[model samples]
Target: MLTVIMASRNGAGWLKETLDAFAALHPPEGGWKLVVVDNGSTDRTSAVVRGFQQRLPLTALHQARPGKNAALNLALEEAEGDLVVFTDDDVLPDPDWLLQLRQAAADFPDTGVFGGRIDPCWPRPPARWITDLVPLGLVYSLTVEREDGPCDPQWIWGPNMMVRSALLEGGHRFDEEVGPDGTMAYRMGSETTFTKELAAQGARCRHVARARVRHMIRPFQMKRSWILGRAFRAGRGYWEPEPERVAILGVPRHILREVGEAAGRWAVARLRGNARERFRAAWDLNFWRGVLHEAWINRARPKRRADASRPGARDRTALSAGPD
Candidate 1:
């Protein structure tokens, strides 16, 4: 049996499409269940799920906490299948997603966690170069064939991932301190960390190309301002070591280094071809801009320490102390 879980917050607009895609995958044998953890959505997210109850074996779990990992933990407690699959609310799985995942699991029974490919559904010409150059969209989506081996700790993403229930049973859970709620204060390394932990436990993790999902891109995400904002937040999340230590003490050097590195890359790409090089240059520039901007904001803003013993404290402390 397989259990599909999704964590959503005010995702009513997109939940219907996500649920519809999952509903289309109900196996004839009827050994699958869809579980949704609604994280205190003010929108009609619950109502939408209620509507889908008749069409699919949908169960909605509510968590008032505003964290993605918190919601995931709630779903994990309810999931009752040999295999547990996770997808984001803004994503729609490929029609044969479950079938492909089942085949992958069968081919490698030792595999504890598996992540599928995700691609942007909408294309923005203005940012196309940035997308192409950085491959920022989905660098972890590997094209390798089926082979049992240790999973790369850095290649996991939550949108299209599956983990054996045994892994969870063994006391594994996503880090609640980071992810979507952490915003600029903390960036997500949970997927990577979780996959690595599983691999360290002598379990195999693999990437399957067939288990695909299309990530929806909103108009806001395409705008330069929004992109830069996300980039800055991502950099802050990446650079800051602990949530409490994200103060003004270490911003200058970090900003200079990030910007300098980006500028150097852009200069190098300029010597290459126009089509690919320009795109690469744009992406590098944008990435650096985000990093530098984040450092500047970190320096300018007042610091507030919340839950000093949180999971990401080490990273935040490192950022506070000095360069990483």
Candidate 2:
């Protein structure tokens, strides 16, 4: 059997559409089930899930916790499938999404991770500014457009990725510090966190372009402030750069070069009145700022342990120092 899991918080707005899509899906060879984890939602999220229980093999779980990873980790207790699929409530998946994922799993049984394509579905007409950031894969969770076949597990997006049950069963869990938490400050990279750790343990990943989903781009995400904020957070998720412990002439060469490049880009973009270029420069600048802040934060604090899956040991406030 296969189990599809998702963590939602106040997602009733578009969840009905997603649930309806799941209802219409034709089960694969071994049959499939749905597990919905309500992550501290005040809306009618539970009601929506309960309503769909009659139509789909649904299981509703309530994780009073605030984070997406927390809800997903809670759902692991109820998961009963050899292949576990993960998605989000706002996503509108194709009818054959499960079929394609199952087929890919069958074809690549040894591969530990499977990532599907995520195409954007704008709620309203997107402005030029919003569309411009799509190619960067920074505004949202869209992965490599031209990428397919075997690729790095880091390329996997959370909205449509699957992993072997054995990985989760082996006590590997998503990093609680990262991922959505129904907050404006939510840091991305929950899926990537677990996938990378699994990859280090000799696991491989595959990209299944055939399994596709339409990622909903809400109106809020189009705002300049929101987009820029996401870009900044994404920088923090990209990697936590270490502080320059050694400096020549009391200055770090890399920091100086990065600052100079950022200033140059910002100046050129402003002079040319290029919105895209302006935001691109801002994104890089913010990323470096995040790295600097993280380095300072880490430097001021003592080193912590590395085990992320231990019960009651996960740091609720610690953020994932993204990919290096």
Candidate 3:
């Protein structure tokens, strides 16, 4: 058996559709169960999940903690089965999603991490301006074309990811700071940091092209402000400060210079460039601003990675949504 786990907060509108899609999934051998953690949602999220109880071998858990990573870490505690699949509540899995993943896991017993394909489906086609400015596939966790073989663990997006349950049960955890909290503003690349650390520690990784999910790109996410904000969050999420590099106000000199250069280019583009060119430049500018913001915030604080910072995280039996 395998466990499919995800977290949702006030996402009831999409949760129904995601569960409906799960109902259509073709069960893999040895069976599977779903574990969804409600991260303090005030909406009908619990009701929606309960409706799918008969359809899936469902286990509902609740984490009052604010962040997505915090919720996911809770699910990790209750998840059974040898393979643990991680996905989002806003995605539609293909019928063979779990089947392919299980087959891949069986074939590659050496691989500790597995990333599946994610295809983004929007309510309506986006305009050329935004399309040209954003890397749709990269930004939306869409398709990353490549052969089914060994790949970087960092390439695994949260929407379609899997790993050995034993690995997580062995104390590997999601860093609460990197994922979505109960807010409009937050950092991106929620799981990449965890995977990067896993790879560095010698966990073999693979990309299974057949296991797929379609991530719904919400309308609000298509807005310009959201896109710009994502650039900033990605900037903060993606930055890796050089330990040996000298810094002023916690930001390295080269990064500060890059910020200046980005601003100048954006100004020039705004004055003379076309719509796409201008937005692209603005995107770069927002990215550097995010990088600078993260650098400044962490400059004075001692560096430490801890999941216990999430409220009540030390309690193993606190999941409020009941057992499987």
- TM-score for each prediction? 0.73, 0.85, 0.90
Largest TM-score belongs to which candidate?
3
Give the lowest summed-lDDT range of ten residues in model 1: 315-324
Taking the tens digit of each residue's C-alpha lDDT, what string does model 1 give over 1-324?
888888888889878888888778737233788898888889999998888989987788999988778898888888887899887887777788888888888889877789787666664543654454433432222223433344454454677788988888867897675565623334535555566567767767687877888776656656555444444344444443333443336555545665777777767777765556655555556655645554555554435323222222233211110000
Tens digits of per-residue lDDT for model 2, 178-236:
76776765555677677777887888989899898888878887777776566556544
Write candidate 3's Cα lDDT for 7-49 as tens digits: 9998899999999999999999999999999999999999999
Clashes per candidate, residues 3 or more apart or on different chains: 6, 0, 0
Clashing pairs in 1: 187-237, 241-315, 241-316, 242-315, 242-316, 242-317
User: Candidate 3: deviation at residue 52, Å?
Assistant: 1.5
Clashes of 2: 0
- Backbone clashes, candidate 1: 6
List the global CA lDDT of all models.
0.64, 0.73, 0.77
